[model samples]
Target: MRLPKTAHTSRPWLIHEIAGDFQVEDVWALATPGGPGDLPRLVSQFVSGDFPRGAPLIVRVLWATRWRLGALFGWDRPGAGLGSRVTSLRQRLPESVPPGPGPANLPFTPLYLLADEWAAELANGTVHTVMHVGWVPDGAGGHRGQMAVLVRPNGWFGAAYMAAIKPFRYAFVYPALLKRIERQWHAGTGGAPPLHT
Candidate 1:
């Protein structure tokens, strides 16, 4: 779906799904070019507020490590592994690991199970959706895009649950996180711009 900006707003963004002919139930058999159908399920962990708000950094680190490791072991398809990584990371975190950074000495029992399930299911194939949310200023301006991948597991409610979180993620979380990253990027390059906010 393409959402165009009106006179009131400067940024215009588009949300589109790139997929081939395939049943939602059989999405796992779909190929990479079809995009991931499961992403919404994984992203729901963040959008539903099931997780505390202060741990994006830790979540990000864990996600990266998990994907790298999964790929190294050949348990996941290189293309589909990213989404599985996010899902697996969320499953690994104990309800006890506070959102903000701290000692994360939690055991890896749950994570191992998650990894095992993903590996078993993926033995056939994995499906993934790479959602790209872009922000473009009013016409004749520079534009940028922030991309995210979603991996969905089976079930109707699970798929619906994942789809529901997409809009909120675009409206809030991703934008804020991108802004934070840009600020740090500027600060490291030379110094932060004088604060006006």
Candidate 2:
């Protein structure tokens, strides 16, 4: 479910230390309920990029449209992405933190991984954004996932792009993706065995 901005801001997340310049774009309480150990599963599933495959048709269409638009406008070209348009957040990460397992399904680059949290990033002409997923106590003696998106807009085009997509993301993309995650959770496919240290 969509959550208030405070739902993300109230927590003292590690992301805050590194991404102080970014703005919180959205926060949602995921529907994947399970034990704390399930966090790895959630992260794994997200990295797999399966949600978009099962998302509603409208979402798929929108995604395709966005990609096409990006290509046509040179919005997602190499020069507009990470290490070019903006330096990666990995440069600011503490040495103690290990890089994430990497993304399989999305265009994002893994930033860092922790016991209960994972982060990945994406950059283009429009913005450099981070997707952070964390496990949180659900107040019922169990745990669920929470997802937040943070972004640093590139400039006027970036801000305009974000504004243009906000309604579609909230109305179609996120809701469809969340529902898919809930289904995966109930089906016991939302997670994987914990990664060995």
Candidate 3:
């Protein structure tokens, strides 16, 4: 993911400019592993009402993923349908649960797509990977938008682990993840010229 120089001075964000027809509808998915127990936990800690309050500003790769994809950018709102789930979880958590550290200062405008329960179970069972794929304009003024894919290990721990191990992850793990994402984009684009991030 490529970002402006200013991105470094601000909160971390990841952005990938993709190729596709801007007019067509697009989808973004954010998939994670673990059972239903993890869903509520992940939502409560990482994807919840307190997110925006803790991590306020964000710059996203201009797209229409509004509610679903906005959380990665730290633009999620408690009223954005996540309220129901959070409310259910709050019933479980005590009134004084500590807040997580919020979003990081990494600089990629995130793109994501959610998977179905069966697909998530399959991916979690063997690979334990969470991926992001977005359908966006091809930037060539075409009707077909490009689908971008980014694969990372399943669980919120990937984010925490990456942070704790940034010096190593950036030099080693991040490059590997980027290569995989680029490869998927190439494959999805079907021999079309690759979009430079």
Candidate 4:
């Protein structure tokens, strides 16, 4: 579910050190409740891009439309993406931080990995954005996963693009994505639903 910005800001996530210039565009409490060991499974699922395949019809259509528009406008061309439009976040990371598992299906590049957190980044003409997944205490003696999206717009075009997609993201994309995650989580956990706050 959608969460207040504080849900991300209040946490002392290492991402803050490298993404200070980015804004917290969205924070979500994922429905995948489990112990710490489950973090890898969640991260693996994210990297696999299975969630998008399960998105609602409207969300899928909108995504295809966006991709088509991006191609037509050269918004996501190679020259407009990572290392061209913007340098990879890895360049900004301190040597102490270790790299996370590389993406398998998603377009993002792995940024950093920690015991409870993993981050990846993507860049295009419109924006440089971060996708962060974190394991947080569920306040009932176990832990669950949360996801946050941080963005740094390229310019007026970037800002406008983000604004235009906000409604579709919240109203259609996220809800469907969450339900898919929940369904898969249950499927793996013997069909028991996770506790939701």
Best by lDDT: 2
Error of 2 at 192 (Å): 13
**CA lDDT of every candidate:** 0.29, 0.79, 0.26, 0.78
Which residue pairs in candidate 4 collide?
A: none
The candidate, 2 or 3, that scores higher on lDDT is 2
Candidate 4 CA-lDDT value? 0.78
Q: Which stretches of candidate 1 lie over 4 Å from their true place?
A: 1-127, 133-138, 146-155, 163-172, 188-197
Give the per-residue lDDT of model 3 (tens digit) for 13-126. 122222111111112222222332222222222221221221212312111233344466433333422232122222333344432222132212212222211101001111
> Which stretches of candidate 3 lie above 4 Å from their native place?
4-131, 142-162, 184-197
Query: How many residue pairs clash in model 2?
Result: 2
Off by over 4 Å in 4: 189-197
Model 4, C-alpha of 52: deviation from truth (Å)? 2.5
TM-score per prediction, in order, is 0.27, 0.93, 0.24, 0.91
What are the per-residue Cα lDDT tens digits for candidate 4 across 1-197? Answer: 78898999899989998999999998889888899777878777666554355567897788778788888998889998888879898988888899877566556788987988999888888889988888999898888889888999989988988998888887887777777777777676311111100
Error of 3 at 75 (Å): 28
> Which of the predicted structures, 1 or 2, would earn the higher lDDT when compared with the native?
2
lDDT of 2 by residue, 41-127 (tens): 888777665545656789878877888888899988999998998999998998889887766655688889887788888888889
